[model samples]
Target chain A: MPIRVKLDERMREKGMSLTELADRVGLTLANLSILKTGKAKAVRFSTLEAICKALECKPGDLLDFDEE
Target chain B: MKQSSLSLRVLKLVLTVCWWGSVIMAVLVPLALVYAASSSGNPKSDWEFSYTGYASGIDTSSLSAVDRDGREGRVEFNEGTWVQVFYPIETSAGRVKLVLLIAVVSGVVLAFFLVFIKQLKDILDTVSEGDPFVEVNAGRVRLIGVLLIVGTFGQALLRLVVSGYADSSLRTTGFQLDGNFEMNFMQLIAGVSVLVLSEVFRLGTKMREEQELTV
Candidate 1:
């Protein structure tokens, strides 16, 4: 929970919709939404690789460590 | 997986049969008691019985009988005093009433056990499909553990009442016969153990849910 995902910001920066990103990454829209909302328990390396490739962003750009 | 499923199905079947059997027994005993009562005349004030103490008097010197209350009734060596275990006091029409009551109560207790088993069977149905650690199961197990504790206490109370009655019946109503209250320690421990396990299962279920939700 401390590892905050900045996926929404990065997605907005690229002007890419969730559905378009899901299709590009070959993941379901529901799972992509979970990632977008930072509700996912984990993001697999393969999934991260696909999402990073799709958004043309680095892992650090989309992930942030926010301490409580 | 297949074997476990098969065993579960068998267990379910056995529990169903036991439930129905106990229910049937509960129904039949009252009817039989009524029939016996009706056939025999009303309580005769002068009716008395001479009890035969054994199946046939085997030398009970080396043997002792334990009552439900954990009292040991044994034959004394030097005094020659015969502490007879619960032999049927007298086989009269009145005794039929006592037997009928006991039979019916036992059937009812069996029915309670049946209901508990049915709950277990339902939970096992979920486990057979490889989904064992559901939240409902934690509640069910806790319920069963509570039942066991409550049921044993209930049984102990019943024993007290019955034994108290036995002490008074057919003789002077005094503390002449031992009216010991039997508390089954094993049953109480089993109930408490199950309750503890239910809490553990509940914790496991919570952790599993949290892990699943964590993406």
Candidate 2:
């Protein structure tokens, strides 16, 4: 139930807006917003791959497990 | 965002109004019949009565007689006691039975309306609370379906009863039992609407479940 989506800090370091990342990854702004706000129930592996490819980061840098 | 909730609220209000309206009709119709029966000034008359062979053992002697117009009649039994029976001149017992049947059917419809609104409220509440995996009780839906079916058939039976009374020679002052073809049509439409709405709810619930699974 508790999954961490680390996005804002990485986006800032990469000098990217959510819109820019979503555009690069071919995802919707709504979906990117959901990921950024940690509101997604689960993220697909394909989506994770796309996000990583667009952000030039490993999955480890993007996702973390949190205590529920 | 709020529009859907507002629409549901409106629907709940409309359903409540319909439920109470039907209930009022259910009560008032019988009262009207009683009032009409009492206000008539025609004197009662006694007449010989016999049941057809189909209804053997029925005490036709005990059945009170009414005027040819269907007004209340006084009958003297073999015991030499005279009793006054209040019967409508234009309506038969079969017609009165149908009115009572309509009252019962209306009450049942009101009950079903209440239950459907309550379940709808529950579903809305669950959805509002963000419970994506909510399970709807299928039994409630089935109950609505059954009520609709019953109401349709009950309306048809009421129509038949009214037609029988209309064709009878009995006449009671201020009391008329007329068959309204429009009412029967409305009843049929209502039944179909309820059935369609129930199916829509079932489909919506199924889609929500599938969405949860896909998500």
Candidate 3:
């Protein structure tokens, strides 16, 4: 839960809307939003790969360790 | 298909049909019983639903025609008909009130059943949404376990009350206890198993959540 997904920042850096990123990564908007809100319990490697592929970022760029 | 696919199968439709059917029947059966009680015109100083028997001639010593008091049971032996009925001494109003109480109990049982059905429906909704594993479902499953445990005792109490109503008249003729008390462990174990299943769901949900975020 402490590992936050920096999806909002990455999407902004890529100048991509949440919906557009979801479409490009083959993920649902709700799930993407869950990640952005830090509500996601975990993430799949394939999903991270897709997001990275779509946003042109490394996993570390999209996820940050923060103390709860 | 994966194991999670089981929740998404046609079983959901089956559960929907059963839920509707049981809810309707649960409401209607109690209503009909109460209506019968109201119409029976018998003095209801006590509980009495109805009872039928075979026998002829009034056994005056049977304490019916003489000591007609607040006893309950539909027992009567006439000179002609080989049937008898008896009821405990209760005001008509008291009997109606008892019937209403029974109906209320039935409603409570139905409500619990409906809650259980709602849990099933929710899980099915998740399955349809392509996810059967969720943390909320663990709580729902635990609720079902508690219901089952409590339901066994509830059903037993209901049976006693219903039978008491029907046999209240027996005091006029005769009354006897046909069985000994027993505590059934099977229902208890079944209820406990459900609790275990809920724990399983909890673990499954945790794993699924982790997998979802593993990226």
Model 3 C-alpha lDDT per residue in residues B28-54, reported as the tens digit of each score: 877787686766465442355444332
lDDT at position B202, candidate 3: 100
lDDT string, candidate 2, B36-135, tens digits: 4444333452222211111112234456867889997654433211122243334345444544555666567666666656655555555556552333
Q: What is the C-alpha lDDT profile of model 1 across B59-96, one tens digit per residue? A: 55677888999998985434212223344334465566
Better of 1 and 2 by lDDT: 1
lDDT of 2 by residue, A1-68 (tens): 46688888789889999899999888888878877887776677888898888889999999888997
Q: How should the candidates be ordered by DockQ, best one leading?
A: 1, 3, 2
Tell me each candidate's TM-score. 0.60, 0.39, 0.54
The alpha-carbon RMSD over the true interface for every model, in angstroms, is: 2.4, 4.3, 3.0
Residue B183 error for model 3, in Å?
Answer: 3.2
- Which is the better candidate, 1 or 3, if ranked by DockQ? 1
Q: Which residues of candidate 3, in runs, are more than 4 Å off?
A: A1-68, B1-10, B30-34, B37-91, B156-181
> Could you give the CAPRI-style class of model 3?
acceptable
| Shift in Å, residue B89, candidate 1 | 13
lDDT of every predicted structure (CA atoms): 0.73, 0.60, 0.71
Model 3 chain B is weakest, by summed lDDT over 10 consecutive residues, at B174-183
